[model samples]
Target chain A: MTTTARPIRRRSAFMRNAFPYFMLAPAVIFLLGITLYPGIYALYRSTMTGKFKLEFVGLQNYRELIVDSTFWESLYNTLLVGSLTLAIEFVIAMTMAALVYRDPWVKAWRIVFLLPMLLMPSAVSYIWKLLFNDGRIISDLLGKLGSTLGNIDFMSSTSLARMVLVITDVWQWTPFLFIIFVAGLQGMDKEVEEAARLDGATWPKIFFNISLPLLRPVIAIALVLRGVDILTMFTPVHVITQGSPAGHTETVSYFIYRTAFKSFEQGYASAASVLVLIATIILSQTLVRRFFRSGTEA
Target chain B: MNAIRKLTLSLWAIICALPIIWFASIALRPHNEIIAPQPIYFPTFTTETWAKIFAEWPIMNYFKNSLLAVSGSVFICLLLGIPAAYALARYKFKGREDIGFYILSTKMMAPAAVAIPMFVLFGHFHLLDTVWALMLAYAAMNMSIVVWIIRSYMMEIPHEIEDAARTDGASDLRILWSIIIPMCMPGIITAAVIAAIFAMNEYLFTLIIASQHAYPLSVALANFSGGSDGIIYNAIALVAFMAFFPVLLLVILIQNHLSRGLTMGAVKG
Candidate 1:
């Protein structure tokens, strides 16, 4: 690894000064090998036929995606789940983070909030699946909550199943939002808040006018991260409903998974992946600009 | 006001502890007493569930696979990630912004999208179901994070040390090993902890690559609980307990990094 290389002494002092450029060579190589190629390759595959004819299909794959029913359903479900999860999580998580941000008594709540985050999402899904299967322990307990709760199949209702998934996702991940929000709040310039308080600004006014604006950058970042996260979520629906009772719970990721693996339609899957990737990039860029144009960094 | 806050904390502790305590007790309790309606708070001890966990299933194999894949990624991340991150941090060069964006963009990538291409790659290499395949996928997925976290930390280190080292006869790699690596230990540990936990808890990639013999503990544990059929409550609870134990211990041991990963910048173990 430490084999000697030719020095840049032959060049002017300016060019020679950049000799350390060689040090950066490997990282760029690895990044290109792993990311740039795959990203570009996905786009390339998206434009080709899957039957191995390798014929160029061009934008037809994009057209098929527009008309693809499963793609639409999955896309709709992804959006629905993302929006619902985000709105609910932000409110609850913000409240929780504010409450626990610097509290000495928060040691336990912090653990409780983060416990599910530690478990693999797939594991969390299975646990919840076991806990909420129609005749499972939770349903059995809810049986006493009311007869309807016991009688109904929790995973059967398209709306209810989606709701459960959204709720489970919120339960498992609210800690992530809480932790970030808490850090954002804790890291704020306390002197600014103290100055506002000396001016006798009401707490609500001070929070709305002061704390939240400072938190916008982080909250936007949290939103983008969580939005993409919930959008691509798969394990829960896979374990809990198997996208079942109907096709209601399958997200775009699962749709892509089944298309590629189950149907052996690699071209179609590639196209779908390209579309999802494009959507994600566009959404991410918009959110990035929204939160970071005035700032910088991903 | 103070009393109210105390009451809230006390209440929340019970809420949090209830599920964890209940799960732990479930693992230790014998089969017959598990379903009793009265609920056995203190049960007679037996080697029953733990012994059954080992004897009846392939958890030990899963355990081994998880450790190997996780540790393998940690080693790879340290070997390859540190030097690269240091360069990006200290050196300002053309395409640096693009390179950083390119690295982070991978963090947002959906595992499902990569599943097919990576699986096809594994097939081409005949690596399916082998630990190597899982390790390769993990290394690829975690490369972005390993770079990002390490770079951020590396930026904080003074360049004067590197300049001083360059003034000596010391080679670049030697400077890295002797000067940089030791100084960046805390940051390296933070990044390693994040990557190791990710590798340890990762399921989707393992599901695609690792089958019965090669499966990680999480995937195997899920299958153990029940798949198409419903779960056997007692047995599933025991498996859940088993699954949580190692991870819970890791979080406690590396509480700071664990919190840092969850939070924005810093928190403590």
Candidate 2:
């Protein structure tokens, strides 16, 4: 039913409802000014191809993207990074959260684990870049221990650069996953674990049978949030790699960068964005639905 | 078994704490010692590098950009977010769930993907290289945050409060201003804090949209590390400390709310 046509049960509903609308008005203005203007502007630009002037090319930009090598490479790298990072984070966060909850020293351990949450993403990415920064400093340090690369080139190589990136990103963000997982644990009633233990359940059995099932929503939330987050890998790839050594490290973000600002292919970039937007929406909805369901179910 | 469990816990904690320690060690080291073949056991700390950070870059401007962007995004998000969240939580409107997801799905979309178009579009509109652009960009970026964070918090407060406010002759608007908002204060604060941190360290949009005059500390930090004289690792470390210290301070202060929100507020409330 339409908003206006809906029947009001009581006269007070209107008066009471005004508060939420009133409360929401400023937020509405805030979002609209930022999201709508930019979104519409992007949409408008997606239709045009040349100079400051607008030319409507319809779906040509979208058609070009299908054949664009860099676009496909970026798509490949984004999936590769996002999926892998999520897998690693999920396993570690779940196992860590489960184990930590059993300890009496949880408060102290929990606090320490959460420290990285405070570190800026940019800073974390920086440290990762530093960790793999040429691996020269590290290799030399390791070299002193009699470990030589032999014929192995580290950062200069594509595979090694990508590996360094995944490792670094995980190092920086695992704390976030830890925090979320712990929060999920804390929200759970203690009796569930206590009851499982009373039933002669082993710790591993209890975890798989009871705790894991209970924490599915949290797991889902962590995965979805982290999964979506990794797709925009920019800082390290931008600063550390610059999609370097023959665009081996190029992510969708970097691809967009080269196209729009670097190549001035506004239409093409906008077309790529529409596809990105669709993928993001589908993935986010699936993950968030699980989050919403768990919230309501709990 | 007991020892194994304890060891496992300790191992995890060590793994978690090591990176921050690495960062802290670098920050504390003097230039001569920072990038050494072997790290020194004990180090002398100097403010000279940090002092130079301010003197060299438009740090204050960057700070302003960060503060403005974070505060701007948070304020706007709260303004719009509180309402949308309220509508979804309290009302049984048709398509409410869809609407909520519609709002939140934007969060899933990679900023980098959207950013490509934005960079090009901003150039065409002659809006390139402005703090206002950063502000505008941040506002959109933060919409999902405001909506989710505030909505969850609002859910915690019972609808009966609004019902009671209605019987007392309070209009919907009045009830939200007087009752609902005050109740959600902590959550809104959390959103604002997150926004602040995101804003302060935000490198991408600011780096793209704004120029040298508007160059933020993050960009300046990147520029300085390589260019701030290759020899003075101490100075660069000091600069690194300057760029990150404030975020650390914020996280420490608001650690409780932020931690709480991250875990359950969005999902459980």
Candidate 3:
């Protein structure tokens, strides 16, 4: 019995060493096929030019991208829209979360607030598109209020069109931040806040001194996740504005899509996509490191 | 202070509910009333648009297609994710943390960065315009969150049970099947549900890969507008409502797990 057990133990030891890799292999291979391989292929394609025929061009696409006004405009539009939407979402979501985080009775609001996010983004964009249509809900409401503003097309003006994009994004995503912040608040240790309160701290004071600092990691995670998403900013532009008014409303994602599919400029679009990808990696990597570092320290 | 809190919550709730209410109101209005010269604030609510959309469009077919694609994607994600998650959670191998971060960083990539090449690859494989393409794309897109969430759940399980099983001469795989899987069933279900939501809501990939045969509800809804006459607001609204209703219900059901799932378990709800 002892001799038999010894061989089995040896075999099992070999198995234990091999097991984790065996379990991870299928997933890793699949992920590589879908993400890494495609990403690398895209990088390769960005340097070559052709329409149904391929010829290598060294950095020509990137060089042209430098002088492309449309590319620059799309980048500018993406930054403008993305920053505005993030700023509004952060303020609204943080305020709302702070207001209701302590209330046990407002649990239903959580589900209600989550409704906007559940809708397919395409559907959400369409809903807003209809509401903002000529003589539609928003326009009609404005007309009823005796404002001449309702008579003009919201999509025809650059500012109004960009505003529509911002409004749509804010409406859909603020709930995401709100829910995360509420969870962060609830999961925090309450003793610090209670101690501060007993030390004659006001609610606002306790919140500022005790709660906010502890919540830094959570805030960082939420903002970075949401910021990464808003950086892409595609569907509303596609469904509602279609980057109209001389392309003032075109975000980077939409610009890439239009270039790749609409004009069939595959190599050129790939270059723009690579630029966006690099920027995102740099931006998110910094924030993610900061978040994890704070998380470990706390 | 309490009054202000209550007031704030109530106001936000109304603000939250208003757009949906407006959508429903438009959905139930008659087409004539919708297109009337003056905005019909109090048109008699009718199911005519809903009925018309159902009768004309193969709504159920798109519904079935969406269900098939999303469920197929979630199944593949779980099949791949669970073992990887368990390995990362329980094993102390070299570079395990790096491997986990590698998996996560894939999610940070913009879909645009990969879409053209993938489209070309699918064209080569003749996988374009098929449910298979959508399923594969969704699985890839959702892999990171699914793996991390499941890993977090696995980490919560006491390691002593597996240790005891090991001493009893049970193989690791067998122990995982019989012990860990049942114990982490809630986490598995949460991951599946979240993956399904993202898969179902996916539009850009579906739009690129699927044109006719594999059109999910998202792409189908997008194509519903701009008929012969003009934009059909009521029909569009009805289809949009149907597109969202399933995910909306699923989200409400899984409200407690969302924050963790959304943040990939970085911050537990």
Q: Please give the TM-score that candidate 3 achieves against the real structure.
A: 0.95
Identify the CAPRI category of the predicted complex in candidate 2. Answer: acceptable
Off by over 4 Å in 2: A1-44, A51-60, A144-146, A150-153, A293-298, B30-32, B35-45, B120-127, B225-236, B243-245, B252-256
- Provide i-RMS per model in Å: 4.8, 4.7, 2.9
For each candidate, the DockQ is 0.35, 0.46, 0.57
lDDT of 2 by residue, A16-135 (tens): 546545545565565544445556766766777885676899888888889988789878887787677777877777778877865787767867777665565666666665555622
Fraction of true contacts retained by every candidate, in order, equals 0.23, 0.45, 0.55
Superior candidate under lDDT, 1 versus 3:
3
Error of 2 at B243 (Å): 5.1
Least accurate 10 contiguous residues by lDDT in model 1 chain B: B260-269
Q: Report how closely model 1 matches the true complex, as a DockQ value.
A: 0.35
Task: Give one digit per residue, the lDDT tens place, for model 1 in B101-174.
Answer: 66566667788877766776787789999988888778877776787677766666787887777765566667
**Which should have the higher DockQ, number 2 or number 3?**
3
lDDT of 3: 0.83
Residue range A102-136, candidate 3, lDDT tens digits: 87854777887777887788878877887787337
Interface RMSD of 3: 2.9
Work out the TM-score per prediction.
Answer: 0.86, 0.87, 0.95
| Winning candidate number (TM-score) | 3
Model 3 CA deviation exceeding 4 Å by range: A1-14, A292-298
Candidate 2 lDDT score at position A176: 77
